[model samples]
Target: MGISDTSTGILKGLVVIAAVFIVLAGLKTATNILVPFLLSVFIAVICNPLIAKASEYKIPKALSVTLVIVLFLAIALSIAGLVGNSLNELSQQLPQYRTQLNEEFAWVTNKLAEYNIAISSAVLIEYFDPAAAMGLAADMLSGLGGVMANLFLIIITVVFMLFEASSLPKKLHYALDDPEMRLSQIDRFLQSVNHYLAIKTVVSIGTGVAVSLMLWVIGLDFFLLWGVLAFLLNYIPNIGSIIAAVPAMSLAILQLGPAAAGGIGLGYMVINTVMGNMIEPRFMGRGLGLSTLVVFLSLIFWGWLFGTVGMLLSVPLTMIIKIGLESSEEGRWFAIMLSSDDDVEKYHTAK
Candidate 1:
């Protein structure tokens, strides 16, 4: 009987794994449709608080939503303009930078040759094309454009979502048998998400501003562009800061010098370390914790599934899933496993 039970459990686990993969495959296939809707949901969540604050001032719901949408559009357009101007300037300067970079590469090759190491200029240029860095910057900008391509759809969806937000409680009450319990669970989940987003948004903005100021002080071109990139990529965890630094640092090397570039890199390292390690945790508190391994894995999984936008939304999307799991008695164990060690210990003691 024990052996039979063990075999059945193993089979059930395998089936569950297969089902999860199937679902993920479908999600990836439908990313074009899903990405816009998911983005709308996220926007609605962020704007909900503003809407509530507006209500306290006796503002009508439709008018409040209109105000928030207008604010969002203005910010979006300003950022786009900054990025566009940066890209245009960078493209014009690329040829001059490319010449300088080739000279630097030749100098490095000669220095290595003095040390009895033969490095071909062709090989070096092929492997490390200075023009390729600009190309990468352009590609990154293009990826942002792709995300904005669905802007109209996302805005429309967000408007409808905001409209439905006030009616969600009534809908839940009508749909669920145990309305109070489900409502409490949902409230907890949204509160946690809102808290996380608020703190993260503030931190990301600080990071962007800090990075921009540092670059500007160092006399780097496109300071605002890099700052905006930092703001967007900071939404991604683990490697996001590193990715944001690369283009700026590369530019620093070409425009300034190795010594100045090193300083710029050090500044980024300090800023990310101080903010990500010290400041964010104090503000985040205990409830929304996720394991480090899970964060990195989710980044890769979502990036693969939904491309760049997926990578940006990975943490929030994963947190939503984790919170949903925790809201269910049967699934709480899985959620606990995904949480930090401290959270896992707390869960054990509570149980």
Candidate 2:
């Protein structure tokens, strides 16, 4: 290629990068509006299966949607009330939890000193703060709780989206110049996203329930809160379960001693293993198209940009983009870049 061609290419790349930055900046600025809408979309997508099943049974779309939404609201409200109460109780009891942490740290420091380790209890307490772990969980969930104040707006949005979903294909057919290919791609994207979110959310619920039950059986404080934390964080790939376990395990150490903490850790391991490694894939049928590295990076990037909700929606958001890219010949390379090796191999094989 000519030097002028190279120069033009460089200019185009620069322009594209600048455009991306501009869009990201706009999104970040609009986060307050964006997060609720995205949350509503998430809810709407998951509820689609119920709507479809209802339709299959010859149930009217309006009645089915109303029923599904009512069910959703009931569950959401119950979780919010319970978690809110748990957080309040936790805040009230934090002083005692902190005192227990100090005693636990002192005992550890004393034991270490017996072996000539000479670590200060203050140093130990500072680094291994159970309250910090709980605070992290609290901060993450509190972000969700804050969004719940706009629950009415979200419900309306979800209702509209659900109603529109049935007509979107027909709309696209009339709207697009070449509808067939576009419709096929849109259908693929919707089916993949819906199946993924549904299965993953169910697995997450299982993970949370299992964790809460184990914690309760072990007599850990704030078991319900930790369970909810597990459910929310499970949306994040790879490291989410670890993050969820930290606070609960820390509390277990402070309240129930190291043995109970060990048991709690073991329970988390088994629950995550069975759910993530075994059950999730069995239901999901294949890997998420994005690479493991991409998943982790998106979690950090989205979390940084949008906080906890961003982290929670990171994989879903990235998967949506990857699928969108794959819909066009020109964009498939970019999609492949976002994909796992297995996905890349399949893409090539299919091509």
lDDT by residue for model 2 over 116-178, one digit each (tens)? 999888887788776686787787788888889999999999999999988888999999877
Candidate 1 C-alpha lDDT tens digits along 1-351 = 999999999999999999999998899889889888888998999899899899999999999999999999899889888888888888888889878878888999999999999998779778766667667667766876887888998899999999899999999999998899889878877887888888888989999999999999989988999999988888788888888888988888888878998999999999999889999888775536789898899999988898888888888888888877987889998898889887788888988
Candidate 2 — which residues are off by over 4 angstroms?
A: 106-123, 285-287
Q: TM-score of predicted model 2?
A: 0.91
| Candidate No. with top TM-score | 1
lDDT (Cα, 0-100) at 75 in candidate 2: 92
lDDT of each: 0.87, 0.87
Instruction: Tell how far residue 165 is off in model 1, in angstroms.
Output: 0.7
* TM-score between candidate 1 and the true structure: 0.93
